[model samples]
Target: MDSDELSEKQNRGVAARIREELARRRVSRQYLADLAKISLSTLEKALSGHRPFTLATTIRLEEALAMRLRVSETLDNVAAISNGHADEQFGAYSRASVAWIEGLYLTVRPSFGDRQAIFAYCTEIHWNEAASNLRFNEKDRLDAAFTQQGTVSIPNLSGHIYLSTNTSGQQRLIIVSRPSITGEMYGILTTLQAGRGAQLTPVAAPIVLIPMKALADAPLGRINPDQPGFDAYAAYLKRTVEEPFAMFLPGVAAP
Candidate 1:
């Protein structure tokens, strides 16, 4: 097939897959448009077959859906259709390694009851390019047995990031999200503790967000726990913030 025909076929496949995925996941057009960084009208047109997806648009879609729309596997040779000549716009992709996702995030998860949030210093991130998945570890656990290890899988049925751990015969699942405008990674924390319930369902609560380092050697100092995880946060806060974290603990009243 000619290059034009190949491109058109790929575009159609992309549109179809997008429609299928949206329908299966019951995702809103506006939500996807916002996540894909595209206008609602443009996303509607592309999904409805009124317009083909541009390379940039396709990249955004891939990131949002965690699925590839094109079978080329490499964006190196994708040139503009004009004059059937290679374009310089895609020359940057020839070097590869552009699709890698890696970073460290100071995460927080909810503690049981009404206790304050647990601040996890996420310092290690492992992203496997070939496997298309990632894992991270948080080392700020006050107790050695309570350390957290996280894994981020490719999106399929859900768009949420989940961090799970199985230790001491207990299972915990923390549904997380990407960084916010304020650079905080916040989400819901849930656990499957049979002692807490009889239905085998997960109990969930909103987590806390404490950025480890917002500035160079500057402190985010967001962890102000009340009872449960306050000790660990105070330990972290003492070294990270300008003020002592003891002031934020149970007896100390952070104001």
Candidate 2:
């Protein structure tokens, strides 16, 4: 069908869902109309299938009625199925099970050069595979496995350990060690500058990945993981439209 027809049908569906939710919650139609800043008559017509909707109007309805419309798949599928453009998926897609670490965080060490390190101060920890198992004299020790390869290209990783590439092609991994809040903003902001329409999101608790091109756009600064608001980077990730994936690791917990 035509775009207008599809949009009209979707609007009707949205209106119906909103009315159903309001009725289920015992909220009056007039109350909803007032909260939505729309006239009761307009609300009635939309709900009764007599009026079309604009994108802004639909968002308003959601805000006023507190109802979420299942439109992502509908829109995504329509574009792909109708236009033969299968690469138009929006939002985050999970490729592999994302792993999480509680106390560990990500920070970019640009000065560290093409090599990134995963440091831990623990008394003892075992390696995943052929990697070395070494005891550290201090609280901070870099995972020599990641450094062995020198600037490994990874889709996702945990605490100085790099994982396989993102077969899903929806994400790219970035490693950052001991970054400040402002430093993170700089990183993401720099990435945004390079990425433009691209977005950012955190797969693990502290590790954030963006389109590889965004790296040039990210700002520079030292980040401290021990301070408050360090996790704010995750919130920033959630604000964007990108695929987010995480895997469960041995010592890490999912947030």
Which has the greatest lDDT?
1
Q: What are the per-residue Cα lDDT tens digits for candidate 1 across 1-255?
A: 333332666777677667765654455788668766789998888777677778778777766654445655343323322223212422212212322324555554443333454444444444422223344455544443334553454343454455655443355776545445665444566665334455565666555344555523322223455444557554433432233211223455535
- Candidate 2 residue lDDT tens string, 1-255: 333332665775676567655544345788667666778887787677777665666666655533334354354333343242111121121212121221222333222221222121111111111111110111122432222111121222322333221211223333332223332211221111112255443323334432223234333233245434334433544432132223334555535
Judge candidate 1 against the unseen true structure and give its global Cα lDDT, from 0 to 1: 0.50
- The TM-score values for the models, in the order shown, are 0.37, 0.28
Residue 21, candidate 1: alpha-carbon lDDT: 56
In angstroms, give how far residue 32 of model 2 lies from its true place: 0.2
What TM value does model 1 have?
0.37
Scored by lDDT, model 2 comes in at 0.35
